[model samples]
Each structure stands twice: as structure tokens, then as C-alpha cells.
Target: MKNKLEIKIILSLCFVTIITAVTAVPLQSAHAFSWPCIDRSDGKAPIAVSDDNVYVAWWGNTTGNYEVMFKASNDGGKTFGDKISLSNSTNGTSVEADVAAFGNNVYITYADNKTGDADAYIRTSNDNGKTFGPEFKLTNNSDSSLTSSSLPQGMKSYDNVKTSPYELKVAAEGDNVYVIATGGDKNDTTYQPDVFIRVSNDSGKTFGKDINLSESKGIVSERTEIGVLGDKVFVTWWDKGSDGTDTPLLRISDDRGQTFGDIIDLSANATDSNTTNTTSS
Candidate 1:
């Protein structure tokens, strides 16, 4: 009778345990949201969102050298994959990096001092962010002559130096990719930084002519950000006028950046005030 009673007790315990487990299991909550899966000890820039996922890239100083890092969240920022370092160089900083995703591919652009003058570089990953192609310097500043020390401070640096301080913006539509950057040749002292756009139809294999965006003479335009919706390409920047005042500006292009409409003043109230601005379409 004792043995029989022991067997009954064991069965009861097992049944209770199973019932508790079934009741304790947590269900997916509607409040659940995506979180960072990677360590963001370094500063992170604005992230780009596509249909499938979101991409975020950042720069950090590691062991006295600057490195570019990337992370992607598949479930709307709920979880991210392992972080990856894109740049192989050890000295230059990766400051203004931007990411864009289309279909299963992700494209990144940033300013790197690996070449010493803060030139622009690009990398693309086909199978999500699993792998990236070889790093390509978008601006050919490899020639040694383009340096402030080599030429007069006021001289143009197109042949000698390439100073592209702003982040490179990229948008992919259909099979073509469009990139925009702001830079100036060293010699045009009167020429503030100008926005330039390039297009690649062959899956980033080659790029086309550079198109200038800004026409304001002697006004310093910098920190450009770009976005695309359908055929419209919009760019926003902080422009420092000759009057020593800063303004937030936006320019839209309906013809794939071939031509731009009038500059829209986003901060009309704060015309001469220093205000940070951002826009998305």
C-alpha cells in the first residue's frame, strides 16, 4: 500500500509541474519593441530604415585608432546581430556614416581619414550584413599633391586634396543607387562646400557624373542628409550665410537630382538663429 501511495504521489507531482509550466510560460506582448543587440559605447548616428530591417553605423576610437562599426536589427530594433568593423585601417576616424537598405542588400557610406585627408568611402553587403565587398574610395584623393601644406591655403584642392567633411547619403531605387556628398576643392576659397550626386546603375560597379546642388556663393553649406521617396530626392543642410547667421534649408529634386526646386526654409521663424533641423519623407 505504501509503494502504491508513493507512485500516486510521484504522478501527482509531475502533473502539477507540467500544469505550472504551461501557465507560467510568457506570451508575446504587444508592448514588446526592438532593442539594441550590440554595445553602443561609442556615439551612434541616425539610423536608416527599409522594408525589411533597420541599419545603424557608428565610429569609435579603439586603442588609439578609429574604427567603423555596424549593427542591424531584423525585428524592428528588437534584436541585432553581432557588430562588424568595416574599415581595415587603424588611424583615421570614421565619423559621418550612413546606411541604406533595399531588398536584401545594405549600402553604407562614410568619411574616412585612412587616406589622410578625410575622403569618402563606400561598402555594400549583398546577403544582408553577413558580408561586404572590398572597400572602395569614392573620391580619388590618392594623388599626394592635394594637401593644404602642398598648395596655398586658398588654392583649390581638387587635384591636391579632397576635404569631404559631411556624410555621404545613399538611396537605392530599382536597380540603381544614388549617392550624394558635400565637398569643395581647396582652391575655391570663395566656394563653400557644395552638394554632389552620383548614380550607379550596375549594382555599385561604376558611378556616373557628379552633379552640384548648391549655388550660394561664399555661403558655407555642410552636414547634408538625403532621402528619397519614389522619384523625389530631398537634401537638407545647415547653411552659414555671409551675414554670420545659420539657416536650416531643404532642396527637393523630382528628376532624380538632375534639377532642384527652390530652397525651402524649414526654420523660417529662426532665420538667423542656430537651430538643428532634420527632415524625412
Candidate 2:
């Protein structure tokens, strides 16, 4: 009986060794996976990624006129769909375009010069960017200086430019969509560039009252980005001081951007003005 038990135990050990050897070769041969990049015929702006996809939006010259184009990838960054134009006007210029996707809808915010002023526009796509809704103007600046007329000469001067939206940012939490951009009053020289936050509960169909996030009076705060964690929304931007130095700043809102907390300095050293980039995780 002892000899028969020893024979059975040796047979079981041999079977285990065979199984391990068979699996080890395939495991050692495994390679890391890689993703594909989107092909932008004319690359322009940096890519932005949400929970599921990466959106690439840019302004490129099409037959001597600049227009906005977009491409999206659903599989992380594996592959992107074909390029699509967001503007219908021939001579209009679209610049500083930003895109963000939430749930089943994608929101694109950009500065359009079709109305003779650099008015803010938002376009929404519900079917995975297969089609977009009508272009809606977010601002009503009729001033000529804010719009682009022709090629080089019609471009608005930066110093005298007013009534235009710049550095657009969008973030969504639950059913609420929040957008932030810089708007300046053309008449008030003492009026610095202010951060305006607009909220929309029904996707991008309509937006609510503008909320000012900065209180520096005449100081300019630009290059803003928004992120949401739980019920709180955080905004980060570079606050430009009178000495021509830009300092990184951050503001947090615990109540869905309805109210923001005190400005928090994000720089490691308070006196260090050389750093230009800031982000919140």
C-alpha cells in the first residue's frame, strides 16, 4: 500500500511541473500594449482627455481662412475618427478652441470672429461626435476691434482688443456644466481681465449668470483650467501682477462652483515667479 501511494504522489508532481513549464513560455513572451495617435492633417492645439476619450481641437488655415477642426478617440488613445470642421462660415476665423466630453455628449468652446468680434461660441455633439448642434454665441461683443476681418491686417491688436473671450475652459460634474473664460470691459481701462464662470444644467443648451472668481481689481488672471472632485470644483490659473510677473494660483469650491474659497498659492516657493504650469489632482 505504501509503494502504491508513493507512485501516485510522483505522478501528481510530474503533472504540476508540466503545467508550469507550458505556461511560463507564453508569460515571458508577453509584450506591453501600445495605443495609436490621432492623425491631424494640420496639427494645431494640444489634446485634452476626459474619462473615456481624447479630443484634439485646432485652428488651421483652410483656403486662406482659418477654421476649427476636431478629432476624437474613444479607445483611450488608440485611434481617432476623421477630422470635422465646426464652423460653416467661409471667411470666419476660429481660434483658441477647447473641448471636453462628459457622459454621452461632447462640448466644444471656442472664440469665433464671424460676427466681426471675437465672440465666444459653444457647440455640442451627442452621438459620439458624429454630428453637432447649431453654433451658439456665448458673448455679444459687436466691436470691430475684437473681430478678424482679413488675413494679416484684419487681425485684432492685442493691446487694444476688448470684448473678446480668451483661454476657454470647461468642466462637468453630474448634470451641471461649468465654463470659465477671461472677459474684459472695453470702456473701463481700470477693469482688468476677469474670470467668468457660466453654468449649464441642461447640457450645453443654455448657460446661467456669470460669476466672477477673481478680486484683484486691475490684475489679469488667465490660462485657467477646471477640475472636479466629488462635489467640489477647483480652478487653477496664472495671476499676472503689476510687476509683469505671473504667479500660479488655485481656488477651490466645495459647493459646485457656486462659491470659491480663498486663493491658494500653488508654487512651492511663494517668491518664485519662474514656474508657469499648475494642475490639481
Candidate 3:
């Protein structure tokens, strides 16, 4: 009788343990929902952040035609303000918008074909993204006609530095701003692209002439990048020379884009040059 009683007691303890375990499990976690910042299609967005402020620049066709659009979030993208059209072009289509931000200053640059030919343009904002200044044209490509000719080699055509049909990037630091692009020479019949740069020391108020960083003709230079650190500027690009081989090159400027030093070949041999090089300050 005692053995049978002990067996019943043990079974009772097992039942109680099973009931406690089932009750100890927590409930399922709630799933997080994704919020749509913009409800438009055909948008090519580029975003930049400065401290708690997040800025986004894109090109969308919500206004009948493609135009540059912008929006800001001061609380780390948790909430975004109303979308604003930065490039409200009436006669042209603005595309491929790029953005850069430093403190209270924000910049948006893109390409437009308002003048029958595509050109680079920029718009700046001082009070974050609340208001923006007037549209500023950055490129003036007057002649882009294709000509036929041939260069024997070791010669570079110094005519017609056209900035269109290629990607352009913008970088800003304090009172200085930079725009790096790939430009083609009108004189070179091969239409080889070269890396060019434009600098603005007064924080986008004014810009200097386009400086050729590649300085090589009949050879293609592309995928240009720029970085600024105080008074120092660094530019890098992938260059394919007459050997038909890709090489990574870099140029440094100590006077804030005023002048660049000699070309510093990142790779000495052709085998070592088939890679992308990036620079950051």
C-alpha cells in the first residue's frame, strides 16, 4: 500500500511540473512595420546624414516630368518631412541627383537637359532642408560634335572639355565644395573620357574652372572619386592606358584644389592595377 501511494505522489509531481513549464513560456513578439518615405515610382535616391539630420535626394516623375526631389528627417529617419522639388525644370528633365551635407549646409547636384544639351546643376540650402537657394548651372558644354581623327600616342587633345553623359559626384567640407566628373575631349575623335574636377572655395557660392586630373588622351579614365580634409584634397580614378590595361591612380592637393601634385600610381604593374581604388577623409 505504501509503494502504491508513493507511485501516485510521484505522478502528481510530474503533472504539476508540466503545467508550470507551459505557463512559463512568454508570448510571441510583435513584428516591426516598414514605413514608406516616398510614395512615388521611378525614384533614384541618394541619401546623406549629418549628426541627427538625415537628408535624401532623388529624381522622380511625380510632377508630370522627372525632377529632383528632397526630404529631411531630423530624428534619425524615424520621421521625414514633406517632399520638396529641388529641380522644378519646366523645359528639361533633371536626373541622377547627388547630395552632401555638413552641419546646417545641404547641397543637391544633378544633370539637366534644359538647354537642348545636358549640363550639371546644383542647389544649396543653408537652414537644413527647410529652404533652398536658386538653381546654379555648373557645366557649359557649348560644342559636343563628334569629329574624326586619330592620335599616334603620347599626345593629348587639349580642346573641348565637355561634362555630360557621364556621372558626376559632389563633396563638401566646411567652406569648400568639390564636384568630380568624367569629361570628354571634342578634339579626340576616339571620344576617350577623362576625369575632371571643379572646386568652390566659398561654399558653392562660386566655382573655378574644370581641372583635368587624368590629362591622358586616347586612354579612358573613369570612376572618379574625390575627398577633402581641411586644406587637403584627394582625387582618384581608374585609368585604362594604351597598354589596354586598367590602373588606379591618385592625386593630392595641399592648397584645397588649387593645384595637385604629381600622379601617384597606386599599382606599378599591369597585373596589380585591375582593381578599384577609393579615397575618404
TM-score for each model: 0.68, 0.68, 0.71
Candidate that would win on lDDT? 3
lDDT string, candidate 3, 148-232, tens digits: 2343243333122222334567888888888876655444455566677777777788876556677666777777777778888
Candidate 1's TM-score reads 0.68
TM-score of candidate 3 on Cα atoms, chains taken together = 0.71
Q: How many residue pairs clash in each candidate?
A: 14, 0, 0
Tens digit of per-residue lDDT, candidate 2, span 1-281? 22232332221111100000111121000000111111223334856666677777887776676678889888887998999999754755566677777767888877665655445677888866767988876664332222233213532443223233556666766666777776553322344665657667677666655556654556766677888876788878877889998877777878776667777778767575343232221
lDDT of each: 0.57, 0.58, 0.63
List the candidate 3 regions with Cα displacement exceeding 4 Å: 1-44, 143-165, 187-189, 269-281
Regions more than 4 Å wrong, model 1 = 1-42, 142-164, 185-187, 262-281
Global CA lDDT computed for model 1: 0.57
| Ordering by TM-score | 3, 2, 1
**Candidate 1 per-residue C-alpha lDDT over 1-20 given as tens digits, one digit per residue, 9 for 90 to 100:** 21232332221111100000
Cα lDDT over the full model 3 = 0.63
Q: List the residue pairs that clash in candidate 2.
A: none
